[model samples]
Target: MEVMQKCCVLFKPDTESKEMSGDSLLEVQRAKRAANLRESLFQILSGLYGIMIVILGAVIPITEIFMSEEIDSTFEGFYIYLYSVSILFLVYVYAYLLRRNRLKTELLTRTLSRSLSSSRAWAKGLARPDTDTKSKFRKRMISLDVSNHHTGTFYLRLGVLGFGIGSMIHSGLNFGSFVSVSGGDCSEPVQWVKPLIHLMFTFFQLYFIFMNSKMCIHRYKKLARFGLVHMCSTNICVWFRSIVVETLHVIHHSDTRGHHGAESGHHPASDNSTHARSYPHSAVGHGISHHGSPGPEYVIHDEGMEKTLVDNMSHVHHISRKLLAASVNASGNISSASKDNCHWKNMMSQAVEEAGPYLYPCTIEYSLMCAGILYIMWTNVGKRPRRPTRSELETDSEDDGVEDEQRAQRMSVDCTSSSRGLFLGILLMVGTIISIIAFYMLVNQEEMQDSAIFLTHMSGTFIYTVTLLALLLAAARMKNLSFHNQQEANLEDILILISYTGLLVFIIFSLIASILAETSTMSTLTILSNVSMLLQATVQTIFMLAGDRMFAATEKQVRKKPGREFITFLLISNFAMWAINTFQTQTPQHNPIQVDFYGPEAWAIFTHISVPLGIYYRFHSTVCFSNIWKNAWKKRKHA
Candidate 1:
């Protein structure tokens, strides 16, 4: 009877274990299904929100361009609409975060209070010390889950802040230009409201990004994803708008310049035939004598010249109408465009117009930076914090040690380490400055304009050639060093490649234009410049990628790092290239070969699309090279 009872007890435990196992399996399946459902919902909602924002972006610009009656009213309404929507969304997200933080705080407080009360009740008549109770409470508090806030590195944050400041300055200038317009009421609410809202949006949006760039949302995933995607789309929309406006401005100015040149009879020798071919009647009528009497030839001249003048004048009139409309308020009060306006207001307007080229780029850069940050935030939504395994922890520790060593090395690095490269870069920079000054000064003179263009292109060719040689040498040196193979491209590399496409596009077009255009000194220089840029970009990309993957091959070579000097030179050269492109290359007047070959409108379009990207590539390359110079080398300690 005892043996039978023992057998029954063992069988009973086995049955119970099987039941528990089955229940656990069911629970796991249910959890997985819930997770999968949540993921699907999130993805569906995200797609809907993205499509809505994209449609909004497309619709707003089209409406502003085609549907608006007056320029000032249209711009004012656009700003108000954009600012309102953006501010509302920003406030929504900000409020949500605040509420979440408050709830977390309250939960912690209540739990602590309950634990303390229980402890006090249990020890009411006991001899337990208060210190021990307090210690236990503190331990419990410390053991609670604390979230990890993965804010990015300090320099990246600083760069974003700096770009934001530039954008704010641009907005501030626009506000001043708007409010200081003559014949506009200083107290008019509509006149100043748009810019005020703009300023506020810029301030708040920048603050939000700075504070929460790396925030990961695990709860309220839908709302978080919506807000982040909206902000990203908004930035992209703004960037597109800015680019379009700048392109239009360029085209307008180019048309004006072309008209002025035709009126002044200062066309380039090669372009005169093209212009004559375009306006054959004007060519035929030019032989007539200029007099007040209406002879047959004089009558013909009047007809042809009038035809040409009317065509040119109509384009100019269209541009003027737009400009004048922008200066007039909704109340029909004309601002600086009118002869009756105040001289001071006119001066301010002119200054703003002149500064637009420089300010526009800043705004473009700002929007791009914001969009990138928001994209990162969007991708991080609903992600949970992962605990590192033992092997990963050890790897992290080793990486930390390497970082510390690199920091020490960077601190010890000085001019002596790269004196030759530094001096050469400084020399090149000084020469570039001189060349730029000379080019700008001469470009305004009718006879010296060609010379100025020649000098600019030649300077570009020289810089690119030198940089290409340096990159090649650096590549060869890198081949001697061993590096770990990186199977996947990182974010920086991906961005570099994307930006590089712009440069490549510009280069290819320029090369094609040079080949098809009449052979001249300018065309030859352009071909050289474009070729050098292409090769240099290719070699530099390889060099940077290889440098990024560099690791110590042996303990003996740990203290020696090559290519720092080359990187220093390349960094400065890229900055020089950026400045050149920003100031000189974008001007349609600078590359008359392209203008003559592709026509002013087509050339302007090409430049507007590509020059900004090229400028960004150079700027970003400098940042990358600086990083490589600072952090690529680390010393290993041997036991």
Candidate 2:
């Protein structure tokens, strides 16, 4: 077993220098675990801070109104401004660190993956019949495992606990004095409410701080064990010395130095004259060549020189390894059998030269982004989509070996059948227009003007009637067959169209009521109508971006780029509208005229709820648009 172990170690050259003993190997493992722990803590802290900042920003106006009595106007404004600015600064710092770490981690992963391929090839040529050799042959091994197993679970647990604790604590504080509350007024209740709000803030903030500090200390302890300082060193001496030298250097440097540097780089006028007088053949194969292009002989000479240098390097590497092996064998541990294995020795040496260091806390950016996208889809769409049936799976499994031929056939079939029924397309067009109109009326009009009111209802009904007629004509055209050979609408498309039509019909009715009604009750209904419109638009936009697999199958398709750009632009515009509307709601000009005992008023509630959803939707849309732009740029470059 000892002889086998020695032979195995001899064959695996990459591990020898970095990990010479069991103790050092254990120490490396400890450092890796510590790094991973720090990374995980960092992500969790970042997420928590982001969530808190967003929540605080959304509720600050309402919170201020609630605390009007205790907080003086000047201090309140400054307080809100200061906190908002601080939060924003922290978010910016986190983002910078995230980007830097992401790049570093990706570079490390790429290098490690490349080295893994080389290492596996080296392991394959060992030519040993022992169990250790067979173990290495059975599977390719990497220098490092690119997984952070407990990281996700840690984040999940922390999130659940934090939210649960926060909710419970808030409820406990509020439940005791629930009935006496009258919307941020009354002296006795106001006193407790102010303290209660402050207490809740303090509790949550302190909890976050404690958790963050604990993690930081733990990280530092682990790092100390490995004698590794933080990547951004905070050493006072280093900073002091750097500042002193930089200050002196800046003072000492003169404008003449740059002029002198440029002068030295430029050739003299005499040299230029000399060169101008020389013939092209004057320095042929010698000194400074007068010709702009190298001759065939010169090119051949350069190639020969490069080949000789490479050969010498290889020879030197081989000789050094042989000498090292001889010294190791003289210690009487390395066997004669290992000495005879020249092929394995050479392979191991090459692997050692190429092998990358172990990488811990691998890049989880792609995985996390994919998970976020999945979660958004799952939440919005609701429930897992049905899996493919056995027959469908089997049909897809059948491969006739030529994928291009199969794809062409599929494309032809899609082209032939991909047309939407005329009725459905017309219905969708009218519904989209009506929904947009209704959303505009609800958002823009506090009190409906007669001209706008008359126009809104008239426009909706007229368009719907015209769209129906257009659909009938389109259906007639489809019956002629030749005009509609391209892609027709599928059942899913028809269902989406029908749903949109139904929503538009409801919105049209709500618009009529919103115009006719005198009471404030209809304000709630108006808000609901606007919500429905936004949701419909959001769902359709998401489907348009992600629905068709074929659209994304070839990003280089010229036709697809314009469609993607249009969708991205549309989503961004809609996001902007939501953002602006949400901001407008917070201003004095847009504040609700009537505040009921239940809440800050229907309009206020709508804005507050929409703001958070809008922020999340805007972020998602921004990510989508960024991806679309990147894809378009890539396609354009290739074209």
Candidate 3:
């Protein structure tokens, strides 16, 4: 009797399963609910801390930009308080994500323990003559189960830590820079405080990296026997996590292949061992796997396993989204209320409003990334294989099975019209051309150092264009597509939509900022760019949550509508700014602004970051707008 644990579910061959006692069933239910509640708490805490960090981060940049050059006593006090808040927020966010990961690890451990116990109990029943085989089987199976512990939790947690640490380091440096200027104007104690803060940040970054690397090495060594790290990924996540987290590997030594017709919803192509172990090709996020296992002739497969996993993960994901929504509202309201309050309250509110947009892109991106991770966890973690279809079984393609490879190559497109793809392609080409022209103008500046700003923008535009083209190609191949496909409207769709919208907002600001830079001083452009970013963030959020569905009234009113008011605004803004730049001349004596908002270095940093982001935004938006244009064109053509 071969007993195996597959995808976190224990399976026994040819033995009638005994029903669990009422007490055991009740205990299991209680445990499940308890685990779910714990997950919810973790998600809520993570979201709350994330919101706090974004709010604080936004304020820092704005404050730096507006900080008075005069060495007033109150100015130092305010700066110190702002930095202190940012540091605290950063620490909280990191701590929360770390705790969340720990919980996930605990859950995975518990599941593995149950699976091992079941496998062990079955092994104990084997005859004395087969003791050697039984012992070997038990060890291999246990090791394989342990290797499955490389859940996406590690990546998610690491990302959270990186964001927090990076923010801390940035804030520390900015605070140090601000205080260093205060010198004799401020007390000697304040000067020493800056050095201490700087040292702590530097030390924390170094120690954190070392400890994380050490842990990854340890995990690699521990799981080496199972061939876990054989084909490591180059993904940023895998690169930094090193070998600790890897894709699922088939345990060939287990000698149990009876996974055919396992669950009703499981795709038949998944039964192919090669497909099961390869990178996700079904429009799912990239995950690696290994295939070395051989299976039995029995048709019985573990059922209800996928449902169990989904039920749990869905609860956690839902909780996370809810937490985020609540946090967004609370943040907005707090900022609103702070407007008429005390000086500190006004400062906090001002930061929330001004910094909200600048810092918001990070929080929004993280949320979407988290959603993607959840989907990957749902599809790959604790997921059993299905029986291969006849065609799949007969195929000679050994590279992760023909069906999966084809699906992987096909690309996932929710739109079915060729016209849509054409329009999208055209939009991308136009945006590409515009970006190139803008790049040319910026590159022609007399100062070579300013080229960094141009190069950054150009690189982003180029990458954005490429992604747009890829998306256009993906959309062109669809057949009989509908936007409201129940399956298509899942969590993945929401994440993709939010991400594209966010990118579009960034691109808009980038183009505006670039256009303005041609005519304005670095300080003026920086201040206005930040303002535009904040506005974009505010509008995009409202549109996605409230206005997106309103567009469903007429397919023509879709969220991606091209030739909309926004495009008009973009065209006018670009044209007006460039025209001003073309006709105007700047002399060193001509200081045009009543306010100098940012340092020269700030301009450089903003350009470096915004240019790449702008490119991605323009590319993504072009494709989306093309789809909208196609929709409108199709309606007009039919009419």
Worst 10-residue lDDT window, candidate 3? 244-253
| Candidate 1 vs 2: which has more lDDT | 1
lDDT of 1 by residue, 504-600 (tens): 8888988987787667787888898889889888877777767765644655443555666777788888888888988988876677667666655
Model 3 residue 378 CA deviation in Å? 12
lDDT of 1: 0.62
Model 1: lDDT of residue 72: 38
In model 2, the runs with Cα more than 4 Å from the true position are 1-20, 38-448, 457-539, 545-600, 611-639
TM-score of each: 0.74, 0.29, 0.29
Backbone clash pairs for candidate 3 read 58-355, 252-292, 252-293, 256-295, 257-295, 257-296, 277-289, 460-615, 461-615
Name the candidate that leads on lDDT: 1
Model 1 bad stretches (over 4 Å): 1-21, 68-85, 88-156, 182-192, 255-344, 385-410, 413-415, 635-639
Task: Report the backbone clash tally of model 3.
Answer: 9
Local distance difference test scores for all models? 0.62, 0.32, 0.32
